[model samples]
Target: MHNESIRYLIVPGWQGSADDHWQTHWQKSLPNSVRVEQADWLKPRREDWVGELQRVIAADSSPVILIAHSLGCVTVAHWAQLAPLDTLRQVRGALLVAPADVERANCPPALRNFAPVPEHLLPFPSQVVSSDNDSAVSALRAMEMARNWGAEIGILSGAGHINVKSGHQRWEQGFAYLYRLQGRIEQSARRRA
Candidate 1:
């Protein structure tokens, strides 16, 4: 990112993103990015995960842009609802990718706690990126969530889950979206000032 002062918060979902995952790659490459470590990745508790994210953010003073995938996406939404106004303001924007529809009927048992995903619009700008055939969520469902959250949506064709298993490593396309989101966030901040 061009903004040297901005921090990148990497939040992974479920068992955590694999070494080959794009989130991991980005964290490794970005000097200012750090993972919001969770206590239990195999069996995530919403309270615990959200608390960890909050702790990490509160410990930092710089503005942050969230990079989240799968369950991590839902976690960010939940935190947005729970974070204090001051802490929330520090978040510049978010890149929510392949967000799992935890509210869906087939919601996995481990992920049930995250069900009823926060419905309120995030105070900061954000974008939702989804694949046409992601098992966690369908294109239509993802688009709906994006609209509901007041975020820009991007739909990619035939990109299953947009994960390593789906062959997404060092996803350059995703980086393009990240850059655009950063620009929008920076522009909005300038206008607000």
Candidate 2:
């Protein structure tokens, strides 16, 4: 199937992306991109997040690419561990950005339950982008998680939190990376053929 036919699901972290967030903009720009709406954003129940993702994936027969930020990245990782291998095979790729340490997010006690999510490599190709000055996870720790997940690392220079507060309005570089990932996905499909 054509890449355009694939479903691009955007998973926002705690508090969910704002109206002007980059993810929201991406969803508007990309034809197939849609947000993975969770039942509760503040309380952040891991099982609920995973269940919603599974439901979304089940609803769409097209390939899926997950774009996750903050705690959402952790949700993706946690889901990967439980999702059937067959369901996982349909995932084309993932873009993990500013993943929360959970162990160090100074998160509320409710969210604290999900800590130090398993550091296992994902079966599908993925990219982990981190900021040099993220308050949530140190650059070193983010790199460590990237290595653990076997994902390519993209370091943002002097960026903090990589959020709206970091002055990241028009993230051209991120779009460039996504374009490159599209090439990688096409190459993988060719290999399968």
Which predicted model would earn the best TM-score?
Answer: 1
TM-score of each: 0.97, 0.94
The residue-by-residue lDDT of candidate 1 on 1-193, one tens digit each, is 5779888999998889888899999999877999998989999999999999999999988989999999999999999999998889899999999999998878789999998877789888999999999999989999988987889999999999989989998887899889888889979978989
The pairs that clash in candidate 2 are none
lDDT of each: 0.91, 0.84
Per-residue lDDT, model 1, residue 140, is: 93
**Candidate 1: stretches off by over 4 Å:** none
The whole-model C-alpha lDDT of candidate 2 against the native structure comes to 0.84
Model 1, TM vs. native: 0.97
Candidate 2 similarity to native, TM-score: 0.94
Score residue 2 of candidate 1 by CA lDDT. Answer: 72
Q: What is the lDDT of residue 183 in candidate 1?
A: 88
Q: Which has the greatest lDDT?
A: 1
